[model samples]
Target: MKVGVVTFPGSNGDTDCIETLKLVEGCEPQLIWHKSTDLMGADALILPGGFAHGDYLRPGSIAQFSPVMREVARFAASGGPVLGICNGFQVLTEAGLLPGALLRNQYILFHCAWTHVRVSSNRSPWLEGVEEGTVLRMAVAHGQGNYFADTETRRRLVEQGQVAFEYCDPEGNTSGESNHNGSVDSIAGVTNEAGNILGMMPHPERSSDPLLGSADGRVLFESLVRSMAAGAVGR
Candidate 1:
């Protein structure tokens, strides 16, 4: 699978995502600049974590206008698999590819630490084949990763099984304390209605190797590869 990792001006996680993709069997990664519209015929797309345009105005405010994002949006509308991590999550929301917004951390701090997230939904191609309630170990580094949505939207996400990941304990239990960043309903990640696009705060790219920490994140990446091989994309 050819995965395109988008790199906005201030994107710092593109290298990490690319390196991780290189390690995933059968994953071919291509670095994409924010200015380019050509997708290079990528099988999947990844908007890496970073402070695009220094996160000026808002986390993804500026980056949303990038030319590449138009292409990204187009691909997403076609049901292509797209994963947005951290700032990428913000961008997805801002671009209207996904619902909700990433507000500033409630405590007003740049929270960086490993967190436990349980799979709330695996309907998306990105998390396809991942069992619900499976706890995953991933790291989050962001100052504005608190996910928020309207009351109705939140309820819909839950009822529709679009809540992809939720902060939880190692045992797969969620609580106020377990929900880092105070995201509503412990939402660490969510997928679009069609389930092809996902916006997540955790950095799975950084957790692909046990040397760095837990390799739990590798499961999601591998899931994508497996789903694609099975011709289950755009689901």
Candidate 2:
């Protein structure tokens, strides 16, 4: 499978995302600059984590206007899959590709650590390998990872099963300590109405390798590849 990893001027995790994807057998990731206007025929697109524009305007405010974002928006609208991690998730929300917005952590600190995530839905291709309610460990690094939306939107997301993942305890349980960043309902990741777009503050690609101490993230990526490949073959 061919995936496109986009790089903005201040993007820091572009290489990491590319390397992680390349590590997957038969999966090749192409690097596209933020200035590029096309997707280069990639089957999927990943907006890797980074401090684009140095987080000048907002986490993803400046990035939403980049030339590459136009292509991303177009691709997502056409049912192409797009995964946005960390800053990438902020960008997706800023670009209007995903729902809700991210705010500073309730504690107002830069958080970086291994946080557990519970799969709330398998409706998205990105979570096909994960069963609903299964908990997986993922590394999260961000400051403004807290997500918020109006009550109606949150209700709609829940009703539609667009809530893909949530913060959880190490024992696969939900608790106060399990909810990092004080996100609303402990939401860690979510998808669009059609389940073609996914955006989350946790870095799944960062944990695709077991040597990195957490291989749980691989299932999400592998699921994406499998789901997309299946769609390609009319399955």
Candidate 3:
């Protein structure tokens, strides 16, 4: 499988994402510059986390209009797999590839730590290796990870199974206390209606290696690889 890891001006996790993909057997992941017009024939793409454009204006606001985003948008429209993490998640939302928006953390602070998350659905390509309701250990580092949407949008997301990942506890419980950024309904991640694209305000690449203290994030990339190999269509 060939995966493309996009690099914005301030995207620091692009290398980490590439390295993680390298850990997967038979997988070839390359870096795609923000200014590149094409995705270089990658089967899938990953938008890793960081302070793109130095987080000017907003987390992902400036990065949305990059030259690479145009291809990304088109790729997603054609049912290609895409995963956005942390600031990358914010970019996807701003670019209209994913629904909803990320607001400032309720506490107005940058949070960096190991967080528990739960898989809310089996429909997402990123969650195929993990079962529904499975718990995961991921690392998060962000200042504006709070996710918010209007009532109707929220309802539609839930109804469509677009709500893919939710903040949770070690016991696999999603409660107010486990809501790291005070997102509505404790949403940590979500997918598009077709489940071809996913955006979440967490750093999965950072946790892909067990030596990093957690390997839960590995399943996400592995799942995507499995989906592409099987030519699985969206649910």
Candidate 4:
């Protein structure tokens, strides 16, 4: 599998994401600059976490207009798999590739720590093959990781099974302090209607290796690889 990792100016996790894809998934990593339109024939796309354009215009607001995003948007519209993490999540929202918006943390502070998120749905190719209700230990580091959508959109998201992951306790209870960001309905991740694009605030690349404290995040990447391979066979 060939995975394209976008690297915007000030993107800090581009290398980390590249390493994760190569080491964890044994996939070829293609570093795509924010200014380029080429996708290098990548089968999967990853928008890793980082302060794009230094987050000068509020998180992903500035990065959304980059040249590369146009192709990314096109790729997603054609049913390509796209995964956005942290700042990437914000970018996806800004690019109109995903629904809802990421707001400031409820505590008005940057949250940086290991957190648990339960798989709410496997309808997305990114989460396919992963058992529902499984608790994944991943690290989240961001001030604007809170996910919110208006009442109507929220209802539709739930009804359509677009909600992919939710902040939850180790035992899979999604209530109270388990929601570190105070996101509405404890939402941690969501997928597009077509289930090919996913946006989430957690850093899955950080936890893909057991030596990094946990290997739970590998489940998502593995599922993505499996789904891509299956798609190739079907084609």
The best candidate by lDDT is 1
Checking candidate 3 for backbone clashes, the offending pairs are none
| Estimated TM-score for each candidate | 0.98, 0.97, 0.97, 0.97
Native-vs-model 4 lDDT? 0.90
Model 1 poorest 10 in a row by lDDT:
226-235
Candidate 2, residue 143: how far the Cα is off, in Å: 0.5
Please give, for residues 1-235, the per-residue lDDT of candidate 2 as tens digits.
8889999988888998898888777679899999999889988899999899899979999999999999999888888889999999999999988999999998898899999999998888788767899988889999999999889999999999999989999767877788879999989999999898999888988888889879888887788888877783121
Count clashing residue pairs in model 2.
Answer: 0
lDDT (CA) per prediction: 0.92, 0.89, 0.89, 0.90
Q: State the lDDT of candidate 3 residue by residue for 1-235, as single tens digits.
A: 7799999999999999988989987679999999999888988899989988998998889999899999999989988889999988999999988999999998897889899999897677887767889988999998899999999999999999999989999998989989978999999999999998999887888998989999888888888878877779442
RMSD of 3: 1.3
Model 4, span 70-125: residue lDDT tens: 99999898888899999999999988899999999997989999999999988887
Candidate 4 Cα errors over 4 Å, as ranges:
232-235
If both were scored by lDDT, which would come out higher, candidate 3 or candidate 4?
4
Model 1: how far is 91 from its true place, Å?
Answer: 0.3
Pairs in clash, predicted candidate 2? none
